[model samples]
Target: MELHIVIEGKKDLGGQLYRQLSDSIRSGRLADGQQLPPSRLLAEQLGLSRKTVSNVYTRLTQERLVLGQVGKGSFVSAPAEAKPRRQLAINLASAAIVAKWDSMHTPLRAPFPEERSRYEFVGGCVTPALFPIDEWRRCMLHGLRQDVKGSGMYRQAEGIAELRAAIAHHAAFARGVVCTANNVVVTNGAQQALDLLGRVLLEPGCVVAVEEPGYPAARMLFASQGARVVGIGIDQEGMLVEQIPQGTRLIYTTPAHQFPLGMQMSVARREALLARALAIGAIIIEDDYDSEFRYDGRPTDSLQSMDRHGVVAFVGSFSKVMLPELRLGYAVLPEAILNAALTVKHLNDWHTATASQHALAKFIADGYLSRHIRRCGATYATRRERLQTLFADVLSPWFELVPASAGFHLAALCKKPLDLDLLLRLARRADVGLHPLSNFYASTPPRAGLFLGYGGIETLDIEIALLRVRDILLQME
Candidate 1:
């Protein structure tokens, strides 16, 4: 690799090179046993004499920072004590804003590979084994080939024409979402869709109602934009529409399946929410993140499909169903805010990646997306069933499973008062990762429970993991 060393005015090239090389070696930026660039090549690149570069290398060898071989080039030596460079503290002009950001909570963080347990029950993650890697690779190659014919200019802010149409058709067929190609705006993910909607629809101090014990990312996102985010409580139906303030400008709901606590919003509640949003002149963001994996009950119409007055903005993501790293999602916007949303999308990041859009468009058009969903859905269903059985038969003493008809995860409320934090700590010690229901709540008093996600872990693993959890509970008693 070429070394990045700057020589100023040719006054002290040796000193500059020596200091940078030593710092890099000590800091471990240059890993131990990594080959250094040829002295002649580095000298040419740095506009320095070969002799000067050799002298610097000789000095580095003397200091034992690099090892010089006769025929081979010098290599970085393992430092005695590799120390990370200390970060300099600087006062910022936007210190208050930075502090506010620091105070916000991030709830959607996934564990690193090293941090993953043998039985991880983390939500919003899909099993990689279920994805059709070969098919997806073909689509990606096709996308790359298609891009070779492009004009090499920035594409439309609304996204590529093919993807917009594909998403519109897919949403219509699968979820009964009412939309055309013109109504769609491809986004980086559902989070970006929410961010764009917040930018277009929200103002400082405006009231934004979100489901309490909700997706924290959405709540915090609206709050970050200076909106007064109010957490409306959820019951068996959904968010309490009656509790939403009259002056609310936006309402975020996961109607298909409530986040953390799994329950579909009843038709009565859905109608009430629509009426309330219409009356208050507010927009409703229906985040249908993972409703495709329905295990039971008939298919329900999306809130967007039921919308008559263009007050609902339907948001959906491929992250939950396919892979989160894809970062592909789209919004079926109302005519009122469609242009504004497109403008915001353009200003945000121009558009979602063209290659990804192309790949997903082909994935949908060629019927691979639906096939993949069905295949994964079956796997998830088996896992969900095993979890339900374990919760009902083996783990019923301390927990009661929430009645949920869809989604890959289920929430179970504690049957009796117990130290949930202690339970979680013990579970972690037993190599069973779990999520607390309390972490999802913002304003209202949180319920003591756990979210058991079946998407990442296998069906057999679910039985073993929860049995471990049962043992932990019994030991605690």
Candidate 2:
């Protein structure tokens, strides 16, 4: 008959109260149809104002998480499933828990509240101000009309015919990838595309190579599949290909613009990587995630374009160029593995949303996609330049900026030893959304640094954000 709760004065008391109560109900600690203490009485028990307690109840009622009776107390609603029984003792041999699942470690992404910061520089995001909402809506409507007129059936596993063709054309012209509609497989997003490829390619105890200070999700995906993932180091040119350990079955690289570090793979390295893959009979995943917004010199030829031995499986996503929420991306496959990949794709998701694919096809074919890219490219270029200038003038003392040719983000290696954990704490206290470079590494000792993405942060606010960062760096000194 004892209730337990802690009131932390430093945090949002009301929100904490709401979340705790809701969790108690959902977890079955608060029984279904059980009456809660009166608002006045409970407020006194919790050392909160009566109004605060009442507001929590009102909000819960609006969410339909609880029900109130007239002249009675608030009660917990019945859950869709039976409530879990409280555990009495640990069962070491319990069959329910998978040992592998327990061993895996994945960090939750930190949420950045715009209201908390004068300027927030979170990465892997696009500027919302440039999204062509009106045009997108029109294209969406056209897709809807076309779908209604056609037979509604489960679509082919590869993708809708129109979309595949459009993607192939875009890849050939824009990325210099020699592919046809038959080689393309549409996916929910680049993440799902990676998943599908992993499913088809990786096996238990298989060896997979990924860049250290690389994309975590891809590494986790391979690890989850029971593949022994090796973290290969990266330099100014990109991942060290010769360093790939022998017997590696699959290689995943973000060559166009390496994730987190934001450096492009050099031409010689690309050629070397492709040749090595061929020599070892290993398949490579080339994720060209965000090369559509090049602000520098001539664009480097894609690894896929140089691929002759069918060693490269090229992945591209609309998340960067168009919008992340669109959940659209495609993979250009090698002929040998295309059928197997298609089967896995079918099993994984059946197919991506059909209407959206059709609409995106029309958008690309009608030249809207290209035009939007040109418009946004100009905006992103300005943001990139501003960030570069700030680092050169102010942040150069503590940080040596990475020379990135393309993508939404730029990273800097620390010139001096920095306490990254402490820096994160100080940055958070100052309302800045700064991330540590070490977070991207798995096995290798991570280099101390920061990745400042100018994508979501507006051009006007870039200077303000950098000044705050500079102030924080000064405090460390």
Poorest 10 consecutive residues by lDDT, candidate 2: 107-116
Can you write out model 2's per-residue Cα lDDT over 1-477, one digit (the tens) per residue?
435666788567789889988787778888788888888888888888899989999988887778999987788785776376677866678544477667666542445454345566667778777988888888899889888987888889999999999999999888999999999999998988899888988889999999998998899999888899999999989899989988898999999889889888999999989989998889999998889889887899999999988999999999888888898999999998999999998888788888898899999999999999999889988998998898888988888888888887899888988887888778778777787787789998888898787778889888877788789878888
lDDT of each: 0.91, 0.86
Q: Which candidate comes out best when scored by lDDT?
A: 1
TM-score of each: 0.96, 0.80
Per-residue lDDT for 252-312 in model 1, tens only? 9999999979899989999999999999999999999999989888877899999999999
Badly placed stretches (over 4 Å) of model 1 are 69-72
